[model samples]
Target: MSQHARLPLTLDQLWQFSLQYYSAREIKEACLHLQNHFHGNVNLLLMLKWLDEAKLTFAPQDWSKITQSLGNIESLLRDYRELRRKLKVHVSDSLYKETLHFELQLEKQQQTALVNCINSLTLTDCEHPHLVEQYCLQLGAERLVRIFIQPVSSQSHNL
Candidate 1:
């Protein structure tokens, strides 16, 4: 292996990959649905998509840590988003706007942390690209989303 050959993909590269993939009209809806309705980490989802594009696959056995940490990170972002939403209507208050802006930046930072963490993992085993695509099903993303729907719906209603 060459010195420049072994590093994992960076988050900025993943972000660019996502921007291009998510720009597709077909995927835009599904991606937004997973993101907005399910409160999924769209960036993570995009990372998986990018990995799939590269024909990379993850072992099902390696998923627990990833999902657990992602849940924790996503939970924090959810809280920040909810609090920011509550304060958004009071934009006349500079404090509220500034605080909301801070929260937005915090969410981005948290996501970057997640991307970095995933990149740091010693991901091994290679399967068909479908492995990553099938992961959401195996992970029960729909079921998880259902659990949080009432709160998410109420949040949406507020918007």
Candidate 2:
């Protein structure tokens, strides 16, 4: 059986800590645990035991349940990307409008300073890189897929 629960922290406690300080180290620790035990060469019997105990604060329930299918971790990545693709197609139109509305609202500012401020907003400006990475990792290509596959008749460059 692979050692998964070696981390001293519980997922709920870890989540609270993450919210408090926006720390990635603790979250990374839990991710490492998942990667080591669940993503890597998982031992079914032990993995199940860990799964029952884990309550999966970070990963989705289905992901944890997929231990039996995890012959190769890369397979999960492929599946993740494919799922992202499908989500993109499904939600593209709505997101396209949302993005446009967001930008337009930002643009509508009468003051040049506000427009500049909005334009200056960048990923680097965020206080939490790990949160961004985790979100992107979760979101994958869904946003891109949606934007790319949006109805051709819709406005393109505005988004």
Candidate 3:
């Protein structure tokens, strides 16, 4: 435990944080690149960003549990995402939008699961910096890490 205690995190906070960052074009591009190129889970990456921003830290086993909790939802999300992508060219604009909306709903479900998982975990105030960068690097997302580490002023232009 750390001296600087904060309120417990919530789904809305994590979702809002993710939406704020993901709204930036450069951040979206970086996240998509990591997802398509490195097989990164976008939700997990966002969760990491949320955790970092909240100054929270968790153990390796806690991470394992989090991932385990998301296993089924991850599969469904992947399937829906793939379907949405494939339908982009074949479906009517309205139909495509519907598919996209459904995919977003699935993403929200994943985020809810993540918030629950984190709530069940033992988290401490951050003892180290650049936790998000380190995790991205471990995933071999060096370029994407820069997007996260850069100042908000720099990213603001891309919003």
Q: Write the per-residue lDDT of candidate 3 for residues 1-159, one digit (tens) a residue.
A: 742245456777777778888998988998888888887888888878766766677876676787787889888887878888887999899999898888888888988888888777777777554657876887888877878866444332221
Candidate 1: tens digits of C-alpha lDDT, residues 1-159 = 112133466656665555566665656676666667655566666666555545455556656656665656677777777877787786678888788678656655655665666665665434445533464565456543332211212221111
Q: Give stretches of model 2 more than 4 Å off.
A: 1-7, 17-74, 92-159
Root mean square deviation (Cα) for candidate 1: 9.6
Q: Under the 3 Å rule for N, CA and C atoms, how many clashes does model 3 have?
A: 0
Q: Rank the candidates by TM-score, best first.
A: 3, 1, 2
Model 2 is weakest, by summed lDDT over 10 consecutive residues, at 150-159
- Residue 145 error for model 1, in Å? 15
Error of 3 at 107 (Å): 0.3
lDDT (Cα, tens digit) per residue for candidate 2, span 23-43: 335434443344443442212
Clashes of each: 0, 0, 0
Question: In model 2, how large is the Cα lDDT of residue 120?
Answer: 29
Write the candidate numbers in order of decreasing lDDT.
3, 1, 2
* Model 3, residue pairs in steric clash: none
lDDT of each: 0.56, 0.32, 0.76
**Pick by TM-score: 1 or 3, better one:** 3
Candidate 1 residue-wise lDDT at 13: 67
